[model samples]
Target chain A: MPKQVDHRERRETIARALWRVVEQRGIAHASVREVAQEAGISHGAVQHYFATREEMLVFAMDFASEQTSLRVAERVAELGDAPHPRDVLRVTLTEMLPLHPEARATSRMSAAYVLEALHDAHIHARAREGLTHGRDLVEDLVRQAITDGHIDPDRDPAIETNLLLALTGLTPLVELGVIEPREATTTIAHHLDRLFTNRP
Target chain B: MPKQVDHRERRETIARALWRVVEQRGIAHASVREVAQEAGISHGAVQHYFATREEMLVFAMDFASEQTSLRVAERVAELGDAPHPRDVLRVTLTEMLPLHPEARATSRMSAAYVLEALHDAHIHARAREGLTHGRDLVEDLVRQAITDGHIDPDRDPAIETNLLLALTGLTPLVELGVIEPREATTTIAHHLDRLFTNRP
Candidate 1:
């Protein structure tokens, strides 16, 4: 069991190294050697964990997504038990945006991976899984808001969920300085306000 | 004048070849040599038009955006004079989505260029310009809609414009099969219906 745990920990370290390389030099430069150097390990040692650069990139992407999810979970947990659906959503979606420096880096990495998905079936499947999971979570919260009379019952939970997800798609604009982070947050709040019009 | 025209046309041909390279083989494979082969020209010929791969890429990105804009303009023109703001908006927005194969390929190319924009300042500036221009056009239409009493006056035209632009950000999801193209169009229509609620 300890051996297995060590194996997982080693992989995580390598993934972290890959992320650092991606953040510092861009995904295009995140080769096995570069990541190995970033991790302060031998290139073969890195390959022991990830045989190919694609494999390493995929693991790093999953690791980054998991980290984001954990951060979102922490923020949501701060709301205490039985928090409002609106607050839960706001926290999750805001974390997903590239508003802050760290989130901005993560968003850039995600953008690169999405493009990579076009050429790599494994990456595409992973991206699809992440998108579907995010959609399901948001859809559930939207449905709960409706049931609790926080939002209008007539609103289609599915459509509302998709719109909210789509709204976060503006992260690139925010990153490009075309949309200010404050304005992006405001737009989210505005959209939420429209949806939660029935709040009592 | 003839010589100038030929120069411009030759560049266009090279850019088109770059697009074909990107469409068939993801942007990573879109080297000057590959594009030259695609264009049925010598590597030196492509170099004659674009001294570097980066220069070629920037030109190709601009070319693609211009093509998309022209297509959108043509679609909008089909609405004829004084088309209702809603129809104009719908046509423009729908045209932006990757609902069809050509649009989908273009969307993939755009996604790749967006990631490239992270590393290349020229591409980033171009992306910002495109985003800003798109935002301005949408904002104007939203303002006109308000003036015409198509949408409620209470809505902030800027925010509404950002939301609509952000909504098209879901092109990646649709490409990943996380959302059907049909479902995406429905979401757009549904959002439009909500915005145009004040329609008489």
Candidate 2:
């Protein structure tokens, strides 16, 4: 009997492959042929799923975002009931960090998209929208922490969220050798401690 | 009599034009013709100075680094006898922020090169070396602050320096709408205050 394949699952698998290529080789090299090879499919099969390179990139970005959201939700769910706001914030914030392999790949792909976005308005808009949604999630978490007394009530949640997201951008800078990794991690840890310790 | 153009000065002027084109239109769009048009010079004149687009870009990066060093040195010199490390750090770090028009343009050009550096080894190495030098400057400032008792002696200067540079990356992220600008600034202010004040 022939192996059964879910079309949706197959598309997602192909998207993942394309994302990895973008992350490792850069968006400029993420051709349909390359993605197809990475996905262990024929170039024509990849073309069948994604008519154009732009379409593949767009789908890949969406796939990455969905994966990110799912991971955050999973981590949040694992906290169970009456979780400390700090713990909630840590899990949420760390999910966005390039600590895990998947997150690291996502970060690289996102960074590549940022460069591509400079020339492509459609991609730029999508990237900006994704970033806004991510920031909103962080803001919501910060607000929850403030209300729960896990963070300083006087602290501005919006600003705190923004800082956290900004910190997220640091990982790529370090990875790109623009800054030292140790320095980046330590600095982030210090900032988070001060931000979450409920101290003035 | 016709105006005499100094070859060295003209070359520098051409490099600045390259920077501006990259800043406004992204690095990929910064061709010899575009740069020459922007500089109000002949396309042949650009080749006489830069040989190729890559050479022009490399020269521009060096020029930017030199300009930054001079500005920081001047600022430090202005602080002669009575030195407030907090104030100095604030001013220096703020100078790096894309708050002003010129700084914003410089930042865009830098970001464009950063994307190029991802694939180009020579550019990547130069970026790495320059970044290391930047971190060293920040580290030196932090060390001075420690000696003067502006920052807590026990506080890790290296980490603090990294944090400052990380914040630099964050500024553009905010400007690009990848993060909320208000939130980013507030977070940075809070972090800086904590770093200098040693408050929890």
Candidate 3:
């Protein structure tokens, strides 16, 4: 009897390989052959999952999104019901940034996909979807803070949330050794202090 | 005799061509042949200028730095002596961010070079040099603000200046259409208001 291969498992394995390659090689060498070599699978088998380079790239981006979203959801669940908006914002944003190795890999992959977004419409939509989703989640948290009276009633949630998200997403620069991590922490604390106005 | 070439002028023209190509196609396609085609010059002519891809990339990055530095100096000169610290900070930062096409092109080329920095040491140094120079300029401005009594004495100039430079560098996300320009401008204005309390 022929051996059965789990296609889904194979795809995940390939995506993990893709992330590893992108993390180390900066996404320029992430060809199917390269990923296959990294995954210890045959090139033909990898292609059996992704038909084109774009297909492979799109799949890799979606995988990154799923991984990040899962991590965010898990962290949120641990906060229990009606968590503080500030904590929610901190966890979600920090998770998205490249503070540690895992986050850095994800961030590097994100940078790759974002550049791809400029050239490919499918990747562009996926990149936009991920960013919009992140913005909405953070926006809702800001809205909750308003309802809970943790901030001034007069504060514009949209503009404030945009600041939070942009500032938060910048941690990757720290990981790149461009900005000192200590400085990024201090800067973030300063902004967060001004943003909530009523932090406990 | 072959046509006489001014080496300095030829290099500048090639650098401009590289920027135009990088502006159009992300740096991944910024190969010598492609750049030569964009410049309407022979590939051999381009090769006569840059022996390798890294050579070409480094030239491009230096060109970007020179362009940005020139713009910053011109803006600062317009402010004259004893300029308000707030205005000085605002002008230096707004010039760095991608609020217009010229700034956007520089920012896009920057994002391209930054990824390459991960794998190329020469490109890495160029990126770091540009960033460090920007930080030093902003830090001096921040220090001047302190002397001018525009901000609280207790504020740490290092941390605050780090915040200012990092936050300002991120406006390209606005140019990417990820964030609305209006929102970015408002958020930046809010931060500046807090940074320099004694504004004009």
Reference-based lDDT, each prediction: 0.83, 0.73, 0.76
Q: How much does candidate 2 score in TM-score?
A: 0.81
The residue pairs in collision within model 2 are A159-B183
Sorting all predicted structures by DockQ, with the top scorer first, yields 1, 3, 2
Candidate that beats the other on TM-score, 2 or 3, i.e. the better one: 3
| Prediction 3 TM-score vs. true | 0.90
Error of 2 at B125 (Å): 1.9
Candidate 2 lDDT = 0.73
What lDDT does candidate 2 reach at residue B34?
93
Q: Over all chains combined, what TM-score does candidate 1 have?
A: 0.95
On residues A1-200, what C-alpha lDDT tens digit does candidate 3 reach at each position?
Answer: 22245776678789889988988787878899999999998999999999987888888778787888888778888999978777676667667777778777777888877776776777777678777777787788788888888987788888777677667545435645767766676677776777789776
Clashing pairs in 3: none
Candidate 1 on A1-200: residue-level lDDT in tens?
99999988999998877766665567767888888888999999988988899888888888878888888889999999988788888888898888776676567677778777776788889899988997898898898888889999899998998899988787878877898889989998999888899877
Q: Which lDDT tens digits does candidate 3 get at residues B86-138?
A: 76666766776777777766766777787788777777777787777767777
Best by lDDT: 1
How much of the real interface does each model capture, measured as fnat? Answer: 0.69, 0.42, 0.33
